[model samples]
Target: MIYRIAMHNLSNPSDAEDIVQEVSLALLTKCPDDKDDIAVKHWLIRVTINKCKSFHRQFWQRKRESIDDYLHLEAPHQRGVMDEVLELPKKERNIIYLYYYERYSIRDIAEILHINANTVSSHLQRARKKLKSILTEGGTYHD
Candidate 1:
């Protein structure tokens, strides 16, 4: 569950951990006495996504630093590719994260993101092109 959430959100391990903790707490508060495990899981996932969105909102409100800084500081060699990925428009970012990270099919990604499958595919195509160009320039993949 943690892996899926992290992948779908492109969240750092630390942030994922924090969100998971928040989800756990929220579940305890919100779940009814007779809620089944399946319902609990669904609620947790929804809460987790909400928490991630909230976190991003707060993070962006503070200041406008280079996204590259996050990439480099977190992982230098991988930073180049990550910088480009992070630079994508939010919709593209969400689509890529859902498809690649979460290992979701295009249909599933579209459902989760509440968009058409074709839109998800288009975003992915553009994201791939942008990532390829950005990484080719000064990415860690340079040999």
Candidate 2:
């Protein structure tokens, strides 16, 4: 899950794997042991987001990496939709992934992304429109 999130945002498999490693290390050394299942998942999602944000702002971002890594993480059937989702800007992409793929509610997405619920809603709507247009252009969308 973390890898998928990182890959979508970074567009590089190696960097996504790096994110997964960092998150795993943090979970081992820093995550609270008392948290429940859902709480742990949220914690992971937050840490992954922070790591990806940090990654984007750092010097290491200059190195070229490939999307080849993404091919194995997702099922064959999901590849098409995921390719379209990757067209979205990072914010909307994250929201879309969390909402549809991770099955989080709008409120949960708001909390996860540290924005208001209304903002999340607006982004989701906008992202849906953009994805629809992209899919329609590809001749895959239907009413």
* Whole-model lDDT values for every prediction: 0.63, 0.82
Best by lDDT: 2
Question: How would you encode candidate 2's per-residue C-alpha lDDT over 1-143 as one tens digit per residue?
Answer: 99889987887887888999999999999999999999999999989988999998897576764454446645665666667788788889898789876878899988877899999989888998978754355554221
RMSD of each: 6.6, 4.1
Candidate 1: segments with Cα more than 4 A from true spot:
1-18, 30-46, 56-75, 133-143
What lDDT is reached at residue 3 by model 1?
39
**TM-score per candidate:** 0.57, 0.81
lDDT of 1 at 60: 49
**Model 1 per-residue lDDT tens digits across residues 1-143:** 74346434653655656677777777778767686875565455556666777878665434434544442354575665665666787677766665665567787666655679899889988887887665356434311
Worst 10 residues of 1 by lDDT: 134-143
User: Candidate 1 has what TM-score?
Assistant: 0.57
Provide the lowest-lDDT 10-residue window in model 2.
Answer: 134-143
